[model samples]
Target chain A: MSGYIEAGYISVFSVLTLYGGSLIIRVRKTEKKLPDLTEEKKD
Target chain B: MSEVNFAAIPQVFSKRAETATKIIGVLALLSLIATVWLGLFVTPPDQFMGNLVRLLYVHPPIAWVMFVAYGVAFLSTLLYLWPRTRDLRFDRLAGASSEVGVIFTGLTLLSGSIWGRPTWGTWWTWDPLLTTTALLFVMYLGYLALRRLPGDPETRAKRSAIGGLVAFIDVPIVYFSVLWWKSLHQAPTVLDPVTGKTYIHGSMAYTLLLGFVAFTLLYVYFVAKRYRLERLKYLYDRVLLDEAIQERKREAADFKAYGADKKSLVPTAFAENGPALGDARFFGTEEESVVGGGEAGR
Candidate 1:
């Protein structure tokens, strides 16, 4: 309810969400640059 | 020249592991949401700390994951160093885990500071636990930086494993700093170190437990994703290096066929409508051209 409590929760959640989003974006970008080796492995 | 054997590159994650990572990620997100709801709306404020105690649900869990991440990195480093078990995969895991650990460590410090501001009336302190934790953050950062230094893969892995080992020496110190020294930072709340008893009970305990599980799952998910990224980057660099090597070899062959006289030193590919001799573009870049020219001259 207090500003400190709100600040703590907001900061933690924001850092985590941002980091998670960045990781997904990076993985997608890197996957695009390389051939899908997972498909190659299947064949 | 031989073909680049794409099959030779190992898979970063198996199909089952990939599926498991996704499941873990979803579970982490759901549980994290639940933890926020329960900690904020459902749980009662502490008798003494009042509303400030809500920070407990998140701070300790983030700190716990920080420790676990570093612990995983330490073990991976050791595995990488062992002769029989030595593998670059362990090095990659160590690097990835340490990177994630650094993030969690940062969050731990940030949240801890926020709590401290209200409870202790100061945003920062010289307390042993806090100082050691800050030190742990810097040390792992140094470890990550060490990994990024230019070197052959084996050399870099070995150097980074040593750096990781050095950084991990502070982990236990950070853990016990509260007990080992007089400090403002509170001792472990979930499990009393002296009595081995849990202090909190009821919804508070359950919510805290959920926070732990949620963050732990998040750590796993993060490490999995980071490890895949490291592997992809490694493979991409290898592919580039292989291409560069193959190109150089072809140029060398052409030079040999034409006889490396002063006038005919240029490879046929370059001699015909390509970049001029000494042109950096012919060798991919200025730096590579200098090195390539040195090798070709020899």
Candidate 2:
């Protein structure tokens, strides 16, 4: 019973955190290049 | 295509927009963590299902969020396609939401499987709920794939928009499958048409409701972040395209100039192979005799 409970909690945590982490990673990567991209627009 | 300079317009989310995104993300995470803590330790185990019931907090919320994401994608696609409000920004939104929606959908399946393994004695079954969900997942996955096809931006948007619209039909079917058919899955615990109230109450119901709210905020953050990324990739690709077109134009110009010179622009042939250069000039004597004799007789 505790195993089932733990699995459920672990799954929830892992999924939500992973999804959030993915968003943060994407935002950082894209943000890093944003200046160059906008500079292109100006040029 | 005619060559044009592609300036990558960076979709800078304004400072205000960035701030809002951060706040939403923080709030969502905080609420979700609170809900998990309450569910795991604070809430009592079910008399019948026992602690396995904890999945109710996470599973239903995830499923609801996935639906919300798909709904956003569908509406955005519709806006893009409608003549009154057609725009590539909406297309960007549609594609972005669809990608996040796919991720959520996949997680829904994964979570469902984990919960199912304990309750159903197997990780998966071809149940109506499960089957329709799997179908929905694949359809949106197809929508994401459609976004990657090579073409002019407008054409690609139109194609992907149409795909996003068509793939959305499965959403309703997935939602209703449990009701319309004999499903092994449980009926809705939150909706009660007969009693007109939720089947749950107390801290249990409270946590579930908060889960929905928290995950909705999470969904907003996910879509916002993903949208920024989509715009970034779009701009980068256009920048590369501009470089390619420019190179091609330059090569074409050089080739055109070379061809024009080949036709005797300032005839190097005379300078290189003439009587002055000590090479026998073709028809030189004939030219001299004809011209000289005519001038002498005159």
Candidate 3:
């Protein structure tokens, strides 16, 4: 394939990565609350 | 729901949540890096398809994730709403699944449009496959809107459960819409019509697999995180409600005690003074004994 096609492929994957990474970061921030629920359940 | 029985939210998620999140993170990294190298440096351009074939990397995975999200919603709804096996946990699961479904469906349409514009020469088409998939997305959105309607949890659960189940029928129709109608959308391209081999080979196949795994992990993480948040909100609401009810009960008890004390004091005053005979005359009674008459009857 030509360099342009190769670049296009990278762009596609880059978009996927960006979208997926953003979601992961959001989840990490919220995960801190998860343990509070477990402790409450035990009590 | 009472305080004791209401589910608790966790400060840290369970193993599934942790694992799924990690996998999603790693896969996202790998997909980004690898696709950049592979698409930009490895894969060659097609003489006819040009750069358009690169879209295959994104479109297929987006469609798969969207379908998988709907599957999660359908399965959870069945487990949650079935009378004999009805489990409220599934309610959270269904909500989480639907949320992911909505996200991925939007992605599917976006990627599909990107692929269509260059190849089909239009951003939108009336093709049967595209039309049905669009319809499927809209129905689940309605399911979500209905879920947010005002009422108690139980009522919301029932309505959304029915909506989830009814919406499941659209999945199959969407899958087969191309077969059922003549359309401009390309027929299934994965199959080799002559050799029966998949069109994808080598690194392309591996990267596609990586994308699939990454999306699946991400979906799981989001759903679990959302479920935990929902459980916490539920517990918080129950605690507040319980406190309110207890406060009301205490107030009622105090009022009863105060009323009883007032009643006892009234008789004490009447009994102590014995209300002189003229007090009866105050009421125009003929005899002073009438004061005791009423108290004695009591």
Among all candidates shown, the one with the greatest DockQ: 1
Q: Summarize candidate 3's per-residue lDDT along B206-288 as a digit string, tens digits.
A: 66666566566656666765665566555565656666777899999988887887656456656565554455534455453
**Per-residue lDDT for B193-235 in model 2, tens only?**
4456778989999999998998888888888888878777777
lDDT of 1 by residue, B3-70 (tens): 55565455544777788999999999999999999999999999999999999999999999999999
Model 1 spans > 4 angstroms off: A39-42, B1-13, B260-298
Every model: Cα RMSD to truth:
8.3, 7.3, 7.5
Interface RMSD of 1: 3.2
Clashes of each: 0, 0, 20
Off by over 4 Å in 2: A36-43, B1-12, B193-195, B243-271, B274-298
What DockQ does each candidate score versus the true complex, computed on alpha carbons?
Answer: 0.56, 0.40, 0.19
Decoy 2 TM-score against native: 0.81
Instruction: Sort every candidate by lDDT, greatest first.
Output: 1, 2, 3
| Shift in Å, residue B253, candidate 1 | 2.9
State model 1's lDDT.
0.89
lDDT of 1 at B41: 96
The Cα local distance difference test for each model comes to 0.89, 0.79, 0.68
Better lDDT candidate (1, 2): 1
Which has the higher lDDT value, candidate number 1 or candidate number 3? 1
